[model samples]
Target chain A: MAEKIATREAYGETLRELGHRLDKIVVLDADLSTSTRTALFAEKFPLRFFNLGISEADMIGTAAGLAASGYIPFVSTFGVFATGRVYDQVRNSVAYTNLNVKIAASHTGLTVGEDGASHQTLEDIALMRVLPNMTVIVPADARQTACAVEAAVEHKGPVYLRLGRSKVPQVIPPGLPFEPGKAQILREGQDLAFVATGIMVGIALQAAEMLDQEGLQAAVINMHTIKPLDRELLAETARKTGAIVTAEEHSIIGGLGGAVAEALAEDYPVPLLRVGVKDVFGESGSPQALLDKFGLTADNLAAAGKRAFQKKKG
Target chain B: MPAISAATLEELRLKARQLRREIITMIYRAGSGHPGGALSVLDILVILYYKVMQIDPHNCRDPQRDRLVLSKGHACPALYAVLADRGFFPAHHLKTLRKLGSILQGHPDMRKTPGVEMSTGSLGQGLSAANGMALAARLEKARRRVYVILGDGEIQEGQIWEAALTAAHYRLDNVIAFLDYNGLQIDGWHRDVKSLAPIVEKWQSFGWHTLEVDGHDYASLLEAIRRAQMNKGAPTMIIAHTIKGKGVSFMENQINWHGRAPNEEEYTRALAELEN
Candidate 1:
């Protein structure tokens, strides 16, 4: 309904704008500045920005060094390289000591089309959230991405902010507040709820609308902050609705789906269903084709919601 | 060159020997710690920390202070001993190497210990981190120098080369690293484990100001650091040749001592050798 914008674009713009205000902020990229959109910041803050070519491990370690020296260093690369490829560097260098390093990763999820499984990073959320002292954030839209970046700057310690490559609809309203460990409940319902994250937030909204026509009310939640999860909001929504379904562009295991299930089991157990990649690697395809093939579409999410709703009554 | 009196050099040597004894005792008390690398790198750390680096134990976190990131962090018994002896912590804390709730972790944890600039253990990442510290110092124009100690076998991690290129590319003259060429690792000799032959050429090829020296020699280590500071354009990598378990008679060049603590008999023998 509105001009679509990629969250990575917002992250880049926010970084460049904030570069003028925050002198302590430094940026580093692993030879992916243009693709990751860190070039926007690099152009503005030439002295403060470092282009570490094609070396993710060194980039992470260098960023850790900068952070230890009292600078808030935001290093950018793809989600696959930022989390999985350099997991040990990120863990030992940044997370272990609780350094104030921001790992803002773009081109996340299966939406990294035509790149195949090698570039598609469906398990980065799982990889990052498992580590101690790592704050994982997945912004839903461009406006929210700006809020997430500013919030990440204020929040100290290690952060893993996931951004997207493809342009997506503006799901959240303009100027909505974004805070760490808080979920935005965009739509309300009773029978079942679709707990979604990242690009799937828009799909969940469409699913909720579809479920309402069938006389089955479904709630839509944008669970952006995966780590330090908003457990209170999740449990509250779960109690109101007897069933829950999770949606994401990531693997069903160890992503938002897994996180929601873990929290729900601990707080309020409900009949739940997870809709995402079924532990299979993504392949070369268009963004829309990949979403449709991996069962990440609204029709698929609506089908999952109906199943969860029926299972709750059963 | 700053003329070092024979007395100062001899005193540094004796202090290094005493710290070696403490390293052995601490590892034995902890029941598990690396001894070979610690013994190999102790003399270099002693010369650097005691003579070369500008660190005030009282203001360990001062922005303008010099720092040393032990990249070969398994040899931290050497670093911990140096830091404790330098009064960064109580001398009594040297008894706790890897004990529970102790400030000294198995690897370096900057948050837990004073004077430890960076948390390192997983190898190859320290030089890159040191490069960051150097870059930060340049940005602040604090004249702060960052030093790094890396193991010969540890350089096989690939991130070390990545960092080597980085320091040289950035012209980080404020950074100086010592490659502890002890020639021995856990598996065997560096030749068998991973031959880092032509290592000096490797660093020079990467645009670093490379040099070779006897790591245990106090005058040579200090001299190399001085030259590194004066280089003005590139980071320096001094390939310091050393012996594994330098002060210990039986453990010298022994691979088994690479990651293990000494037993009662070995500890007694090691202490006796150090007393000389």
Candidate 2:
């Protein structure tokens, strides 16, 4: 079994180190510093950290102001509150002006577990990606979360980085450079492609192994950046594999699945299957149970791959 | 605080009248805008740009300069007029208010307009941004002040109270906010619409130094600002009681003019009143 680390934990640790290197870095939290791991940065840089109580809208607006004043502000909260609650502020204040605000929202998707539908965020990527100047990133695991933090800060404009709660396997090895708006092929196969983001990347790799045993060669691609998506790589995957399965711990409507389908439909027509939560809210359940219920497990990805493969044949 | 000199006050009053005239003309040309709030807030903008704020249009991007966020951004005609008069840009650019590809947007866009500190059109967000500016100032150990203006109706937004709490919680003493208490929103009278009565007490409870003044009185406005500046450890809110469409005879205290552009005939009458 591979070592597992929650992306939120990695985000916290990354912020602690980045705080030392970046003098202009400021962290704001709507009273979720400890949960979002912004507490780590708050501890290191007391003056630079601002805990804005439970005011998510104010936190986002304040981050925009800080960005306007030549500060790199990383605002952290739960994904639901950060994106859904403060959509107007994110759209008008940050994205409209193209401010350097990094919205690092953690505990997204069904992995929020027993916190239930209210806490779970299955629509954040869709919301953030639609905004004009917003950069949307969903890192696959702990190692990738660090790269996301670096990329978000180094990138001059606004960035929305989606992070998760439950511990997931670290598929990307240590010391791998993270390139924004680029896709990486983890495993090479020709029959079909499993393109995934966030925690589902691990599941897609596992599903590829399962398919290989069934005499079906599958390719696994990690697409970390959802917006400014690597259309070139997606086009190549469509041309080579001829079928595509997109998996994410989000709704099938407008996440990795929606993005890949849209790209493939426009650029390279192919049989595409979206392996994710159907268009419905999640319910209270254990993390593993929720993944299984939502058809977000490796088995589900393999099934989705086979379905897409069969469609290609048809 | 010492009284503003007679000459300075008279100069500002004259400048306020000129700005009011400019506001009417710009709105008349734009074909659509919120003239009532712009006229209501003119005196305050005139005082801030001409006397109070430590800013220079030439050094608009200077780090140490004082910041002003026009929170009630629907009244951006007032702000655009003041910014143009202060030489932030060519004065002729004022004619292009709300035109496509023009810097003078219907709302204050910091990216487009020169000397506009933070892009703001949405109500209730400016105070949060002001709090951020103050926080950044404190972080840099820079002794710069941040000024924000809010509408009487805008404070009805839940985000305003959220930001008020943030300013008070963080003890942003460098942030001074003004409420354009003109007593009217688009729908009707503010009291009838949603009673923000005991408004001063509300700010007092929010851990701020609160005061009320005649919004059109430059002396009283300056005095209140002086007191706010002298205070420490918390933010301040100056609820300036103003009349909507203050300088125009027909438009004063009229809720109908809240978001209507002045027609050609009304423009002539308004300009005549301001000229007088």
Candidate 3:
């Protein structure tokens, strides 16, 4: 039976584990402790935690300095503030110099609930993934978010880990080996493929089941690492299933949709349908209501998969 | 604790003169570099790299070694010259500055260049980076200190104050920042462009241990740095007053020379004046 786990909870647990093991791992937050779930780490290790007010740029710059001095600094904030607010600091102090800092951003995409568009970061993955030497990870659920946080600490360079705010259903089992630049094939089918990332992974899995009822077998692959993007898995899946539907909670431009298009355009050209927020801002609503309003639900994924299949048939 | 020897101070002054000449030569070779700020900061760079900072070029990556960040990065020609002269790299590589595939890039690249502590060019950022280093050093119980040089014009950025508040909030006594108060920026005089007057009062008000000194006076600069190292509970700021173009008569205090390398005739005159 698949258990439902919130990525933020997993992150909190994983941080506590890492904190106990590694004495040099310090956690810094921009006053969004409960929201980002860094309070878990703070509770266990009071001396190591630093609450840097609401200054995102200072948090990143400080992390860079800490990384320089041989400590692995995990700076957490909301996805919108972490990426959009302090982009220059991250670019200059972290990515440009290749510092060993991990930015764990929570409340990403429309799943952030009533906080709405200003809080939601639909373009974070696009912004972070485009920077050289920056590893971008979007875990499927809480369990996977924990796994991704652990993996990011071990990775040698800067990483941007995107997590959702709402309680998401955990599709991946606990103790599963999570590695960077590798994709997890949740289910295998031949007729069509539902490629997804982040919280949309569970939605893609549900959509696969719905498509199965319609006599179309839809394969599901969780492309967590957006930059090193599992090109081999995508290429082989495209060869097997003549169509692909990339589902993400980000903008269609320069995101998972764009990554899939770039991979397929070069290796294997397939009929691709991007299921994401069009060029529009989100609004104040519940997580489920916003998912429906933005066409990011499992039903939307099924529709997009069916449309992609029909285009392949033509 | 006492004053530095007179002979040693004179030797450092001569070395600063030589460093200014090297800055001119490198910029002239590149045909494009920030000469005004580089010349202005030559004395401060000479004193820190040669006499003040506890560092070794041979063991450049020594964890316990003192760190220096050139926050006023447009003036990197002088730093590149001084580091090369210190044997961080071969002195000959100075000629390849600003060229394709050269380690001597327009700005300092910490990865490419030895003895360059942090990669900085964007203003109002290096001090914040230094604060992190200081905080980390404290966390690890390390005794190494951090120094950052900022441009007077660069202090106009808001992020500098953000870093200022942070450094004070953290009480990072292990960090000391130097402001190259040459009074001129790329556009015009700093007073005309964006006045950072009462700069000492500003730093003092921000809770930093503040000191004002003639940047060209190696002894006073060294004493100020010593006082900063001895002080505890807050970071220190040394507001270094200097001439924009220190050694060259024609380029002295001229804002046009901020980014421009001297032509053949001017370079010849500048080199002769330095030799004399």
- DockQ, per-model, please? 0.89, 0.83, 0.74
lDDT tens digits, residue span B212-249, model 2: 99999999999999999998999999999999999899
True contacts kept of each: 0.83, 0.75, 0.57
Q: For each candidate, give the interface RMSD after superposing the true interface residues on Cα.
A: 0.6, 0.8, 1.0
Candidate 1 CAPRI classification by DockQ: high
**Model 3 global lDDT (CA atoms, 0 to 1):** 0.89
User: Candidate 3 lDDT, tens digit per residue, B1-276?
Assistant: 878898998788788778888999999999998999999998999989998888888898888999988988889999998998899999999889999989988988888888887888877778878988998889878899999999999999877887888899889999998999988887887788888878889999999999999999988999999999999999999999999989999989998999988999999999999993
Instruction: Give the alpha carbon lDDT tens digit for every residue of A192-253 in model 3.
Output: 89999988888999999999999999999999999889999999999999999999999988
Candidate that would win on DockQ: 1
Give per-model TM-scores: 0.99, 0.99, 0.98
Greater lDDT among 2 and 3 belongs to: 2
lDDT score, candidate 2, position B42: 88
True contacts kept of 1: 0.83
Clashing residue pairs, candidate 3? Answer: A6-A142, A7-A142
Tell me the lDDT of model 1 at A211.
85
